[model samples]
Target chain A: MKILVTVAEVATVDDEFEIDGTEIADQYLNADLNEWDDYAIEEAVQLQEGGVADEVVTVTIGPEESEQTIRQALAKGADRAIRVWDESLEGVDLLDVRAKTEILKAVVAEEEPDLILSGVQTGDDSWMATGVSLAESLDFQWSAVVNDLDHDLEDGTASVRRELEGGVEELSEVDLPAVLTIQTGINEPRYASLRGIRQAQRKPLDAKTLDDIGVDAGVVDGSLELTDMYEPESESDATVWEGSAEETAGELAEMLREKGVTA
Target chain B: MTDVLAIADHRRGELRPVSYELATAGRELADETGGDLHLAVISGAVDEFGEKLAREGVDVVHTVADGEEFNHDVYVQAIEQLVDTIDPQYVLVPNSVNGLDYAPAVAGRLDLSIVTDVVDLAVDGDSLIATREMYGGKVETTTELDAGTALATIREGEWPEAEGTADASIEAFDAEIDEDAVGSTVTGFEEVAGGDVDISEADLLVSIGRGIEEEENLDLIRDLVDALDATLSSSRPIVDNGWLPANRQVGQSGKVVTPDVYIAIGISGAVQHVAGMKGSDTIVAINTDPNAPIMDIADYAIHDDLFDVVPALIEEFQ
Candidate 1:
């Protein structure tokens, strides 16, 4: 069995992200692997180590900086890494979701993996629908927010349990060649050791452009443009609780009722 | 015919509260476009669910009797076929676990412009402008579709529930679901980690975090919960430690809550945890760290220790 895991490289903004007119203050941002994709990478490695998959491949789409992130995945146990980046892919609000999905479809077509796993959503972009959209673009059945997963290679099915709102868990069974968006707490990601990191430097890491994936630059258009991003205005003024604990407690209760927060 | 299609979501025969919310939003769009608002419900038996959706603004309730619960294959197949028949300008679904499952497929298959987690909607000429939260709940963005059909999933709790009480007419439509095409079957829903409390419905939330320090200290927070008649919830740290059940956790990973008042104690607000409770009407934070992220958004903040402050809050309520 073959499994493909996709990860995103997110940036940690220093201070609050700022805006000078319509342009953003991009200098404060430093790219790192998205927090949510840790589970996807870990799940992929676990499936391989457990013999559920014969191979595990990691894919990412970002600038050249994302290669570092792919290597980190390699260090953790991915068999190989492929990154999609082009000069045209640079800047904010570009690289349309459908176009990105198409590029991924091309990769999937080339790899012909039986299973695909991705983070439920990225820390940035939060394009929450991309994983399912990718599945749709590929004409594959999918389940989102999956927490528990088990594969029956002989039966040609996968048991997936999803984490839903209000703490509700739903179990489902999907046939082979499916897409799943993994939620957190599925597995504990192993830290890359010195030996693993050294070995990762020698692993197979490839890069591709839109042309290489057979996608036209004309298709790369922003559906949602970034107008302006800045700090929101304060909700309201709040009186600080002062003096000793006992007196403040009394004041708190009175205020709760005053605000109609307590009946 | 080019109107709005709102999907009425239900689980185990009960209408999810967000169904009414979507109906309300759907009606607004229908009016703006000068077209009728149509609602869809797919289950093995749809009469009960269909009648519930027959509201004032709802011109028609499109029902498809297919399965007991939401199935991906059924939803995608049913909704895609429904769009072709109704010729809707906008497709509205709740940005929920089940809704997100099939919404993307519908949008991808149709090649429609999709905007998700929508909190607000407006019509500008032929484009539907959608307002949604970006970068956690810190920033709000309004998205304009550049395509013909708009596929969006609304963020629950941000909009008021639909109050249109008109008795809408029901219209049954076949999704033509082929069992062979269905790759998955939903079996059952189980409780995550055996927690019974539904925090989303709480009127007030008294949430704790790492500041409480240890498992033994949970009693102090519980005391406050009982005094104020508030629900006990926590951030991911406490849940990760097993100090509280996963259901008691409040964050992006747990549940999104919108209550009248949220009193966050010893909780340093991270982006993930803030997303779940930022819709709160009033926010009060108590922590020694005045620089904590939770303090910035708090309506009222007290810079103090949890052990000293929580006990006092309990006494004041008493």
Candidate 2:
């Protein structure tokens, strides 16, 4: 089985940051592989190591600067990488789920992998819908928020543990030519070793344009438009305990005593 | 038609509370659009769900009796047929794990614009503006959808549940479900958090988060918990990192804890984490970043590093 994982480079804002129009100011933004995708990549890599997957390929829809993040995936274990970008995508403020699904669907058609893995949601946008939407569009079976995936694929069925709300997990089986949105805690993502980082430098990282991928630039022109961005007004009327660590601790202890909490 | 169609969510024979909230949201939008609010109660005990959902603001309850549990394929087909029949302008679904499983497929199949996890919504002329959070609750954003037909998944706790009884028209619609398209089977559900500790039963909870930094640092929190005679709990990341067990996790997917006091240390207080602990009588946040979302709901906040403050707090009790 050939496994394909969708990887995204997400931007995390600093604790104290400035919003430039509809985005966070550039200086306060830090780019890294999305938290959920990190686990997905590890799951795919482990499947390959177990011989259940013949190859593990990663696809990312990001700009050239995202190569650093893509290499992180390759350094860990993916065989190669494919990145799709275009000038048409540069102007888009918010890349809606459909636009992403369309771009990834085109890639899936080209790759023809037996199974696909995507994060349940991106850290930045958190659409939490793309993987299932992609599966539906491609006519593939899918399971969302999967925390565990069984490696035995002899019957072309993926037994997964879907992490439901309120401490419950649903055990389900999805037929192959399937997509599973990987949830965190499925596996521990390994750090890139010195040898793996060296090998990643020589690995294949191919870039494709929208034209090359057989997707129209108009896909970026979706009906969704990001019109406003602002910090939510703080609802806190918190009594800030300001002092040295000792002084603050003293205040907290007094409050606990007053409330009869430290009896 | 300018009508709004909302889907009621259910699991394991009980209707989720978000279903009623969806009704409230659907009614609000329908009123703005000058149309009726139609609620679709699918699967399980359809008649039971429909009768219970026939509350004020719900003009119609369309029930489809299909599978015993939530099957995405069943949902996609039922919703498609309903859309074809009702032609509602907007379809609202709960921004839930199950809703994540199907809402996008419905939108894709129907060729409608889709948005998820929206906290607020408003209808302005021909456009619908959805307010949502991004960058882990650091900022809020508004996205305007001008698409002809749109589907949105609403955040669970954002809207109030529908109240008062209304004489809503309840009707059954038979949907053509393709058996071949249903490729997944839900075997059973396991409660993974059932162990020695139940955080929900705790009184004073000392919850730690990503700010604890290292596993060795957990001893600091443990010491404080021991000193205060409090139960120890944590945000999802600590459990995800394997530093803690599933039972200790406090979040949407874990335990919903309402303690006498919730002392959040280094936790940024994401919406999911907040959902689980916001009901605490007193919220105290101790973190280096004063602007963390936890501080917003905190009754008392100490803007200091947990490393320095936790040891001091423990000493105070000693």
* Best candidate, DockQ: 2
lDDT (Cα, tens digit) per residue for candidate 1, span A104-159:
89899889988899998876557778889998888787889898897455577889
Q: iRMS of every model, one decimal?
A: 4.9, 1.0
Evaluate every candidate with DockQ and list the scores.
0.47, 0.86
Which residue pairs collide in model 1, if any?
B56-B164, B56-B166
Error of 2 at A57 (Å): 0.6
Residue range B109-128, candidate 2, lDDT tens digits: 99999999999999999999
Pairs that clash in candidate 2: none
lDDT, candidate 1, at A23: 39
Per residue, candidate 1 scores C-alpha lDDT tens digits across B1-318 of: 568999888886788888888888998898898998999998856988887788778889999998888898888889989999999999999988888898888889888878788878888887778776655554566667764888889977666787757778898897788888888889888867445888888889999998999799998888888888889999977876667878888876688888888999988787568878889988899888765678777888787887987887776666
TM-score for each of the candidates = 0.85, 0.99
List the candidate 1 regions with Cα displacement exceeding 4 Å: A21-23, A92-94, A151-154, A242-263, B193-206, B209-232, B237-243, B251-263, B266-283, B287-299, B303-318
Candidate 2: stretches off by over 4 Å: none
> Which structure among the candidates has the greatest lDDT?
2
DockQ-based CAPRI category assigned to the predicted complex of candidate 1: acceptable
Which candidate number has the best TM-score? 2
